[model samples]
Target chain A: MSDALPPGATLGILGGGQLGRMLAMAAARLGLKTCVFEPAGDCPASHVANHHFRAAFDDAEALTRFADACDVVTFEFENIPTAALDAIERRVPIRPGREALRISQDRLTEKNWLRDLGLAVAPFAPVDDAESLRAALDRIGAPAILKTRRFGYDGKGQARIATPDDAGAALAAMAGAPAILEGHVSFAREISVIGARGLDGAVACFDPGENLHEGGILRTTTLPAALPHARATDAVLIAGRILTALDYVGVLGVELFVTDTGLVVNEIAPRVHNSGHWTQDGATIDQFEQHVRAVAGWPLGDGRRHSDMVMENLIGDDIARLPEIARDPAAAIHLYGKAEARPGRKMGHVNRRTGPAA
Target chain B: MSDALPPGATLGILGGGQLGRMLAMAAARLGLKTCVFEPAGDCPASHVANHHFRAAFDDAEALTRFADACDVVTFEFENIPTAALDAIERRVPIRPGREALRISQDRLTEKNWLRDLGLAVAPFAPVDDAESLRAALDRIGAPAILKTRRFGYDGKGQARIATPDDAGAALAAMAGAPAILEGHVSFAREISVIGARGLDGAVACFDPGENLHEGGILRTTTLPAALPHARATDAVLIAGRILTALDYVGVLGVELFVTDTGLVVNEIAPRVHNSGHWTQDGATIDQFEQHVRAVAGWPLGDGRRHSDMVMENLIGDDIARLPEIARDPAAAIHLYGKAEARPGRKMGHVNRRTGPAA
Candidate 1:
């Protein structure tokens, strides 16, 4: 295990999206410098990081140079080319480890891994071909979502099936890639637990946020999710189990479905998650700082939300309201600095505080 | 007057000290880009700004290049050699204006300007020679401070005259420079108001913070200062008067002395003030962001102090206690990312919240 990093240490971050931009800024707050490695020129994170390695993620020489400069390495996203990680991990430590990345990268593997740990998750089965998909559909039943095993995000690369007759069309929707057939849980509400694991074995979780989705994209997340105290404690404990089981060493976002039976895990992200953005305003030390502290081997921060907050994502044209939003005293606007406001793009988010909860 | 700046606009900051570093970070948080212009390499702000202009402040070519890139120009320090500001001001607007800078850059000018505005300030006199110094010392009385009219800060370039015998020595300390001898105001406590004025001429002010100095350097600033409601209102009004008189369009830090009679103006800083650092944790929007918004021609932010906080400067070796401080869940650390822990240097600051006040 690596020792804790000093203040002046350089943190090498892969990817230069809004997540990386926020991460770099958080690292700066703690006296750590960040160097961002991104293929795109003038990316969001490049404007804030201490340094920018403008090169592809798969470039071996660039990865070597990056690792040489960084005391420890971390990534904002999980889709980093495994070979690039292999090249850098040998030279420097990568928090959340390769095992966590490998498992979280595939939907079928992640579901099976969670089931093996005896955690409750949605019923899912692997579907590699049309025959396998047909067989899995028979076993998992109709009214399922067929999602690509890898690189699927934001309702992309996924098709919903209503009946057995629609199965072939759903399989074709996968474009012949590996897929997973997941049985939908009749959830009453959706909530997410943002948790962090430190360099030591200790784990800490922030208050869960009740999530609302529109068109398969996150619209809002309300903090202190109106869950029963016992259930809220269970959500935190479940997130801890997942982190400890994966030997995770960073902030993880676990999206859960609040069903009639109990809480069921829908997915887990290995880095700072969108649902945890409320912590930026409501918590003492936010999820971005938590991720930085964990990756730097520092102890986890206080996870309690000091105030009640509702986070709303500013997708695409929602940015037009920024001028008026800027005048709102209750809202804290966090824009990603993206140039183009394409439809469905994650432009930014606003955290509106609802006062401190007793 | 300039229109409001959009999120992608670049802000040109002239100075790369801790103030600029914090401002750059704040601009990044708002999705605004910043380029730092400083003569020194690897300065604190350089690490966080999107672009670094490593040239002297008076470098006309560099200033021109910088102005061409920026939508507006603002500065962290007031001593930005008038010629450089002239070069940049022709290309884009500089918030708080050159008039504010000219008055605040010199002690005598600032005091006179404040006194002319029907404000309460300590009795003072400008001294150009030893004879004038003796005359002024006699008028202002002994047990006073003889300070350089220009470039005096952190109690440097200042000498104490305890008695008539000490007059000559104190005058000699200026080393052939203009000086100001001001009579001391025996005050109850020191307080400062951080106020912001946007392009639209609306003023917003944070609650006053009680300041404590050790060895002529700011040690800590406590928010929601122990003051009567009327005195606080007077302080805010006085600050607004100064802002309106100067036609200011950015955050201003006004130091005041609470005397038996009323509030006496100590001095005013034209940019974000160290005493206002508590707003970063205690308020919805901080002084840094307020300054950014004002300079960017945006509306002022909410200046309410949401929580009680005490900001302690991590000067020099004080940073050694970071590990212990980090363990204190209430303290949010903001390090400037300086490589060395030089004596008396402000390496970082810690904001310890005392909880939300009623």
Candidate 2:
């Protein structure tokens, strides 16, 4: 509803993690100033953003000051506290809007939304208590995943059920929070599409990335994914449909399962996704910039891949290879500027160009 | 020299113009922090650098404080005050070393240094006064350029001796300052090689970017410069030789005139050059990062061009084309956060990729 932001306008970023760090860097490249809101003193985004508000997300005064200073507000994480949004929404517009966040915050709502749109999704049943867990297991079957309906990320807040007998433990793991039991779709491969929609209703989606995971954490995302041509096309169309349906004006990462039946929707992230990191080196316009553009009311850029790439995440102690990564001329290294590289921590990434640009 | 700077090390930047703005961004990509020293509040680099020292270049107290905080210092311009360097050199190492700056600070010294090294240069004579200017003009021949020995850039402090009769006014233009009169070389094309040398003596040179100038300011620099393959090789080797001769530990810009016989050295800038701007999109590692790496004692990246590119400068009101430039996916637009766009001011640049990356 607002006018397009000028080049020198300030972009207010919520959650100053690696995503926000890259976003701040991208905004700065476009001559836009960024103010990051994060409680941590050493948040990665704080290192690069023009200004930093070191306060709790729900700190009303801090939120007021940050929203007052920024020309536009956009957040990277979906789990942003409703109270925080409530405090800031009165001051500035939030891109992707509150509706997208409300649906994505709960697993059941995301699945139902996809199903309502006539998209294929893994069979899922909501579980609120023990009585419902048993009833849902009967409907969804064993060897399914029971995930908390809200507040989950990077393999957190979820448990797998091997059999019907294991349902109780999975239910107990939810700790009384609402849960969704998703039956395994027998996926051939995991793929993700990073889609963006601009303020003027223009939508763009990158080619699906063949994703690989290690211990439930993303390890690598390779472009030119090994998928049937039809499936790849289907992925982009589905992603665009979701973007348009939500009236989203920022990047959304849609996870998919290449199943025997077809491509099944896994979930959606209302921000730049890890699987899209290859865009930094392999594409003319990267996803971070795309998100920034969409949030600033600028037209969406080409999400087309320019080069073949393998984007590898440098989690935890993987940062020890910084020296080695630096030696390779083709290795486009991006470190989050985090102070410490604790085990299982995401420190940096390397996007290696494996082939020629398109 | 100290060991290679780690990823999180702080790099002190001497200037805060667009060049420094780019250097700070590149340093951030490498997970390094930058502190910029500039008196202006709205300097382009101040918008992105991690820390800023708002003080005059000649302020010894500020210089000492800056050096004390940084791991090492590197400048983005050649005209850094000697007194500032004198104050900081004892506290922190300055990359490219003082010798390169000392030689480049004076046109006569730079030319003589190149000639003494067996490098081809325009035939020149020193002029200290009107009589000497007339004598130099006669010796160097007409249709030559008369340039002040010190503090000259962008066609400033220079005049043309169009004919033998035009010497008096040209001498007066120098205002009795020491000057150099050099006979011009008829060239096929003007080109520049961006070369780098590390503290450990490794050298790398980017492919020459053939340049065009209007009103003495660079208008465009096209890669794959249309030079004979052998001449291009010679350009790189000559750049490397110059880097080694100066014991430089940072990026250097070497301008050359391609004549019928061979290449003739015009001058050298002891920092990142505008001519190398194409590397931002055409190479995996750009010149700014190369400069930062060299100054930080790290290995030089492959300076080989990946994609064919034409880097066009957006000077003055040319920035009004943002809407059009933003429509081109292949245009990597880099805008300096400068508020005013005075005529001849470099407001931004656009690197248009023309071919696939090699």
Best by TM-score: 1
Worst 10 residues of 1 chain A by lDDT: A1-10
Can you write out model 2's per-residue Cα lDDT over B182-295, one digit (the tens) per residue?
997999999999999988899999999999988888999998899888999999999999999998899999999999999999999999999999998888889999999999
Top lDDT model: 1
TM per candidate: 0.98, 0.97
Recovered fraction of real interface contacts per model = 0.72, 0.59
lDDT of 2 at B82: 91
Q: How would you encode candidate 1's per-residue C-alpha lDDT over B1-358 as one tens digit per residue?
A: 2387888899999999989999998898788999899999989899889899999877889999999989888998887798898899899888879999999999999999999999999989999898898889878898898899999888889998889798889888999899999988999999999999988889999999999999889999998889999999999999999999999999999999999999999999999999999988888889999999898888788698788899999999998988888777778889998989999999999998888856
- Which residue runs does candidate 1 get wrong by more than 4 Å? none
lDDT of 2 by residue, A1-358 (tens): 2467877899999999989999998888788899999998878898788899999987899999999999899998999999999888998998979999999999999999999999999999988888888888888788899999999888888999998888788888989888888998898999999999998999998889999998789999998899888999999999999999998889999999998889999999999999999998877789999999899987678787878899999999898888778889888888888878887888889988888843
Residue A88 C-alpha lDDT in model 1: 95
TM-score of 2: 0.97
Best candidate according to DockQ:
1
